[model samples]
Each structure stands twice: as structure tokens, then as C-alpha cells.
Target chain A: MRAGAAGLAVWPRWRPVHDNGELKSGETTMAYSEKVVDHYNNPRNVGTLDKNSAEVGTGLVGAPECGDVMRLQIRVNAETQVIEEAKFKTFGCGSAIASSSLATEWIQGRTIDDALSIKNTDIVKELSLPPVKIHCSVLAEDAIRAAIGDWRKKNGAE
Target chain B: MAKRVESAVAAACPGCAAAQEGRALFCAQCGRIQPPPGCDYFTVFGLRPHLNLDAAALEREFHGLSRRLHPDRFIRAGAQEKEWSLADTALVNDAYRTLKDPLRRTEYVLKLSGTWGGPGKEKTPADLLEEVFELNMEVDEARAAKQAGKDERAQRTGLEAARARVAEMVEGLDRELRAQWPAWDAGAEDTRRSAERAMALLVERRRYLSNLVREVDEILGE
Candidate 1:
């Protein structure tokens, strides 16, 4: 019953990844994009900002059916309009959390105008989000826009 | 009664000197300790692999085997017998746990046969796609109402209604799943494919129910 080398090909085809970001044998959730897991587990600058400060801009967004909420805040320098810091809090799935976390990281060190240009597609590309979790990326994009809008209103820029 | 799936396989009973079928726990001639590894849970308990099972008999067999496999009895046995008892006891416990619950048993049977590996990815239902957009908007409105200190009674009611609707949908999926169980038990070649379809449906149902529970929790402040 010894077979040729072609018989071994079936076993190799199923192993997509090994050890690195590999899911356990019987995980129910989709195979998470590696970057998503990175951002989710080690989210950057996760905290609250002084909402009353003229320098801080806050955006809160939630999806009804998904019941997930994301809060993103950015601190912009008054004169330069450059982002000094960014932080976010997400109460959702791993994808949602990673989306907001990556958003906060991307907003930091960029000018307000530059940050505004950031899109959900960039997040999707960076995170390798599947179709089901695309909304999480969209939520991140919306948060960035909302936060920038709030900042502009407070600073009389818009 | 359990029928051995692999007729060519045979084993010597450990407890009493007798030949037993593959994956059978007790010898037909002498009822003694014999557990075959990787045996299906139903077979472990001397029952046919079927969807509609006798609950009382399952419980009785489970208790009896658990007592037989107790570590206390292996105190004087040799190293091999002791190892066998320990391994078999753990397997017996695991088998009992899976077979006791209908949902777990269904999933276990499917997974054991290697017919369905896991839930398929990226197959969003068209109906869910349409509903998700509106539901997200409603969530946004509810949040805004709460923020503005507006009367939120209506929003809460709507959320409760959504939860009830989801529960009803889950119940429907459960009925659909149960209806297919008889086909699986019939063991026709065509029924195998039907069982695979039913298992896939169960996976989708679980996903939808999980989302509904999350939504209800957020709305109800749970």
C-alpha cells in the first residue's frame, strides 16, 4: 500500500501557516489577520482624553446590530495643526478593537489635514480584514473623521 | 446496541481473557474493562450512533463506566493496566460530556467523521447584509438619543423586539437542524451530504445568535 510522492501533496495543501498567528485546532472565529491580533493585544495609547480641552478632539461611534462602540480622540497642536497624540477605546470584537487601535497609531505625528485623508481601505489593507469584519475598518475611518470634525468646530477652523 | 464499525480489527480484553471487537469497551462473553481510543462517544457508551438517543440509558452507562474506571480499583494492577485505566477513564469522561448535550453531540459526530472540517468563511447571507446596514443606523440613533437625554423608552423597546426576533430565528434554525437528524440516523449515502448541509447551517445559526446576544447586551446595559 506504499504510495508515490503525489499522495503526500494533500497533507501539505491544508497547512496555510504554522506557529505564527496560527489558530488552535478547533477555533470558531475566522483566522485573524496577524496585524489585527498585534494591534488588538497590544493596542497603542489606549486611554481617555480631557474632553473639555480645546486641544483635544473626541469621536464616538457605534454600530447598532453589532453593538460595538469605538471612541477615538486626537490632540492637535493649536498653531501647527499637527497631531501631538492620539488614543482610542473600543468595546467590540478583535477586529473592531484593532481597527480603532491602528487608527490612533496612524493619527499620531501627522497633521490634522493629513490625518483626515486616512481612509478605511488603508486600514483594511493594513489589517487584512475579511469581508465580514470590514465594518470594523469603516468604523475606524468614521471615528477619525468625526474626531477631526469636532476639533475643527472647537478651534473655529470650519 | 453498538455494532463495531471495523470488523477486521480485534483486541484482547484487559479485564478478563476474551476477544472483543474493535473500539468496544466491554467483552461480549465477559463484561470487563476494554476501551478503544478514538472510538465515537456513542460507541463508548454501548449505544448506536443516532441523533435521537435514550437519555436515561446514556446516563446509566456513563455512571457505570465511570465507577469501573475509578483509579481506586487500579491500585494493585500492573503499570500497563493502570495506564489503560487512567487513559480510558479520561476518554470516558470526555465522551460522556459530549454525548450528554445534543448540540455538542451533533457537532462532535460531524467533526469525528472529517466530513465538515470547520465553519466555512466569507459566506454572508444576502438577508443579513441588507439588515446589518439599517441595524447599524438604528444603533447610532439610539446612542444619540441617550446622549441628548431624550426619552429612550422607544429605543429600548425596539432593542428588546430585536432580541426576541433573533431568539425566534434561532429556534427556527434549531427545528431545521433537528429535522435533519432523522436523515443522518437513516445512514443513506445521500443523507451524509444532507447532514453536512445541516451542520453548516448550525454554524451559521451560532454566528447569528452570538451577534444578537451582543446587541441585546449593549442595548439593555447587560
Candidate 2:
């Protein structure tokens, strides 16, 4: 309700002011990787999937530390159990956006079980996420597992 | 100079070598400023570590200390006394700022007691995760409508409604936080720890929801 509270990061418009930019005095700045910048600028599969559909599984997760929320959905082939489409909407810093964008790209066309193998470390390595931003990659990995879990629960596959 | 003043304990006053019992910023005997005490803010005010306090009394005490410790009053004093005055004033100012506000005072108590780890140290509870995610979805929809430049009134109405709901939620959380004060202030160790955990979560949840409401207000006002 206070004036400055609105400035906290939420989604879309208020990008991380200094995620890949300036640093406050006495703090060191780390440049985002070129790949992270690219994915953030043109994020892939940024939207929602049909939550009501039997074949669609939605995963919603958040990191309270930075107040980042990510929702990822996957549409699976009923017979093949392969993820045919993946979409994501991430409200976070550049590292988070890049991680989720890359997640959608990696999970699509892979079977749900295979997608489950994707690790936060892989995203971290791919995006060159600094130590401080590693949690964003972990969040992306959690979203993948949550989506798969949701699909399994809906399918009674357990 | 101020850093050194903060780090050392002024056990004895440099001006008159009077014995100081606790970490007090001014010598009782000599009435001269001492080093900024190596103590918590509550100690600076000579109060017990507690959440509830008399705000009026605190303000009066702060003003009285500020006036006495003002550097201008120390201009003709010894150089060391002058430096001590500046350092002690800054310390009192920091202490007062942290203690005057309810939320900040709660956070400072938890931090001093080592019961609450800062953000990123603990796993966010699942319920808060769901609430925050859903709130973001609504915020995103409002933001999208505003960006698209379509159905302006509908967007404004939706945002206003959402803002009202979030404000109500924040009020609820504030009450919940306040309810834990008794356990924190007087209970046994187990009860205090549980109260600490609950209070910490409540604080974080309140912060997130209030931030969402602020964002909605900004969109509506724009």
C-alpha cells in the first residue's frame, strides 16, 4: 500500500533493473551471457496452454526470495507420452526468463520421462548463470518436474 | 573513524575514565559522548527485546538523545568528544529508524534473535507459492489489457477490484502477524521458535501481496 512497494518486480514491464546492468556502490556487477540476453529479448513459447484439456499439464511455481513466479504447461501425446508442445510465462529476472525459455525449447518433442531428466545444472551451464542467479535455473527445473507430475496425476499414471 | 567507534566497546569513558556498566553511548559520570556501543538497537534505547512498545515515548527519547548528541553542541568540545558526538548521533539515528516502524521493528527483533534467516535461505511454503503465482496471473492479465489499449474501463475496473482484494488480504496477514507477538514476547523456547517461524512467513507474505496491490494501483492510476 506504500508508494515504494509498487516498484518491486512483478512481471513483464518491470524487468530486473540491474540483473545484467549496473550495481549499487560496493557491489560487483556481472554481465549476463550473450545467450541469456538473446533468450530474454526474444523468449520462446511465451503463453499459456489449455489447462482444461486432459492432455495438457500445467505447473505453477514461485521463488519467494526474489518474488519470481513461473508457470509452465505441456501438451503430451496421449499414446506416446511425448511432450508435443511446451509453453511458459515467467515473471522474473533475465536469468529466469532465459531459463524458462530454454526449458520449453528442450522439453518439446521429448517424452515426459525424458524431459524429467533435464537438470537445473544443465540450464545453468547453458545460460552461464552466475552463482547468485542459479536459483532461477532451479526454478525452471522445478517447473518441468511439476508439469510432469501434474500430467501423471491427471492420467492416473502415478 | 566512525567505523572504529562502532567496533570498540567504550567500557571506560576516555574523557574521565568513569566505569561504564553497559554499552551506553554516553558516559553517565562525565556526560560526554562515548563510542557507538556494540549493541542492538533495543539496547541502545535501554529496552527489553520486545515487539510492542510505546511509540510516543520512543519518539521523545529519540529527540532528547538527538538534541544532546547534536554535533553543533560538541563544536567547542575536545576533538575526540566531537567525533564521538557525530558517531553516536548516527548510531542513535539508525536505531530509532529501525525501531519506530512496526514491520521493521519486528524484522529487527527476529534478526537479532537469530530466529529468522533472510530471504533465499529457507524454502518458500507451498501455500504462499500458489497464492503468489495466482496473484501474478491476475497482475499479468491487467498489465496485458493496459498494454493492448483495449477496453480501458474494463481493465481499470478489474485492476481496482484486484487492488481491493489484495488490500484486504494484507490486512488479514497483518493481524496474523500481530497475533504471534504474545508467544514471541513471553512463551517457552518451543513456542517462541514456532512463533518466530510463523511471523517470518507472515511478514514475507504480507510484503508480496502489498507489492502486488501497489502494482495494480500504479496501473489503475496510469
Candidate 3:
């Protein structure tokens, strides 16, 4: 169990296991990642960084014309390539916020390689997010990967 | 052709009681000129002229109405009705787009109220008025100086500076609006007064930016 995993305990009880081994309860259960939703419903690490010391990576993505803007930040250990912190600010709907939150939660403490491998589908499946809202999670996942990619590129960590 | 059938349906002109068939320009019974086969933006969305609207509510309504009235759902209708539906849906889309964006929202709100293109509808705000006047004067001076064959460098420099200032102001206003939005959406009852005040400022700032952009365009002969 992680710092935030306790919140998910509520889901397994209410969720009915199905033939596909997926959880189904209601529309609320259908559209959001439980972790993402929890973070959106209660966001963590919601702020900025000391760009000088933090080996920071920031990603600003999404189109407000399509009606969502998300900013993702990651702080990584320069030598170890471990993600030390993650934060986000999003101008979007619930699913977008949840996706960002879920991504941040998943990335903290993981090595850059591990973080990179965590797919958008993993986040979607973890939270059971619906198709329409999957893009939101994908965007967050992309932002994280982008920030890491940027960090690696800058530091010659290819 | 499908277009011909659509034109024939439109020839009936739904608003008028007249039954005009092929080759008729005016209604035989009412003599009203046949209107194009589409609804106007306002009537299509079923909204009256209004400025202060809940945007989220409006979006919900638009999506809900679209589910019922969009032409995609009307493909089975005969050519005429389908054409009319498509045209009407396009109008609805245009209306939603215009009303959704803050700058366009302000312009359309004024236009719908018959306040556009009139003298003394309300003077632009004092701060905006000063900027507008200053920018206009600078442009005029530049043009005059150019025509009189004075040093063009000074005028060119002045024009660039003026354009940069307007751009910076627009960017600053956008930042202010974005910064204020989350606080406004938090739904604190006590914050309502402050939110309304902020919204007023945002609206005014948007108007000022629009005017400034137009003035700059005029100066550049765009």
C-alpha cells in the first residue's frame, strides 16, 4: 500500500468483478481512474518547483479550444534517475484533473525507465476511465514521458 | 439533384404561409421573399439576447439540443428536411462558437441587443479610452510624418513599440483571467462578489484588447 492507495480501498468493496476481470459499478466508476479521481477530487503536490536545484521538467499541453490545458512537472535525482517529486496544474474537466493526478502519483520514486514504461492504458485501466476521457490520462502520461525525455535529452542520459 | 430538391423545399419558405413551388421567386399567397433554408444563430439555439449566462449550463444545453437536432440524426428525412436540418445545425454550431469565446461573446451580445454600430452605446472605459486614443494618435502621426517625408525611422520605432505594448497588455489580461478562474469556480459564497468584480474587469480588458488590435491593424493598413 502506498500513501494514496488507501483511498482505493473503497472501490474494491463497491466494485463487482466481471468476466474480463474489470470492475464495474456505475457511471462514476466507468469514467474515471479511481486514483486519478481521488487526486482530482483531492489533488496532491499541486504547485511549482525551484527550477534551479530541482532538475525540473515541465510540460504544458492540451488545447483550450478543445477545452483542456494541463501542466505537468517532475523533479528527478540527477545521478540516480529516480523521480523525486511530481506536480501538476490543469485547466480542464474532472477526468483531465484525475488523469494528471494519477500520473503524478504513479511516477514518484520510480526510475525514469520505469516511469516511461507506464502506459496511458495502465492509468486508464487502474482507474477504469472511459474512452472519451482516456485522452486526458494519455495526455498526462505523455506529459510525464515528455518531461523525462526532456530531462534525459538535456543530461545526455540517452 | 439533392440541391434542387432542397431548393424546392426552401421555395415553400417555412416562415411564410405561402406555398411556392418550382420556379417561383416570391410567395404567391403572401408575396414574402423566400428566406434561406436555415435558422439564425439565436433562434436555432432557442436563446434570447443575453450577456450574463452560465457558460457550463449553456454548453450542456447545446450538447443536449445537438443530440436531438443535429443533421447526423436526420439523415433518414427526405432531402428537403435533411438539408434544412443540416443548415440549421450549422447555424447552431456557429452560434455556440460565437457565444462560447469571451471576446466573440461580448461582440455578439452587443450585436444582438441592437447596440452595435450605434453612437453613444456607452463610451469605452476610461483606461481603455486613453490607450485607444493614444494608439490611434500615434498611428496618425506616423502616417502624417511618412507622407511629409520626415525621418521614417522614428515613426517605425514608435509603431513597433505601440504594437508590443498592446500585445503585452493582451497577454497580461489573459493571465489575469486564467489566474482568477479557479478561485471563481471554487464556489465560495463569499467569493461571489469578488468573482463578479473580476469577471467585469476581464470583460472590459477583453474589449480593450479587441479595440487595440483593430487600431494596430488599421495602422499597419491590414
Best by lDDT: 2
Q: Which tens-of-lDDT digit does each residue in B1-222 have in candidate 1?
A: 011223323367655667766566556777655555446778888899887778999999999988888889889978866766776776677677677877667766666665433333333343543344345445445654554557778767776776677677767777777777888888688877778666655645454464555556665782
Among these predictions, the greatest DockQ belongs to: 2
Model 2, span B1-222: residue lDDT tens: 012234357668787999876568778888877778888787787777778777877888798888898767887998777777777887888778778877778766766666554444566677887777788788777877676787888888888888888899999988888899889889999998999888878877775686677667767776
Q: What DockQ does each prediction reach against the true complex? A: 0.04, 0.20, 0.01
lDDT of residue A148 for candidate 1:
92
CAPRI quality of model 1? incorrect
Candidate 3 regions exceeding 4 Å error are: A1-36, B1-222
Question: TM-score of the candidate numbered 3?
Answer: 0.39
TM-score of chain A of each: 0.82, 0.84, 0.72
Q: Report the number of clashing residue pairs per model.
A: 0, 0, 2
Per-residue lDDT of A95-120 in model 3, one digit per residue for the tens? 66667777888899999889989888
- TM-score of candidate 1 versus the correct structure, residues matched by position: 0.54
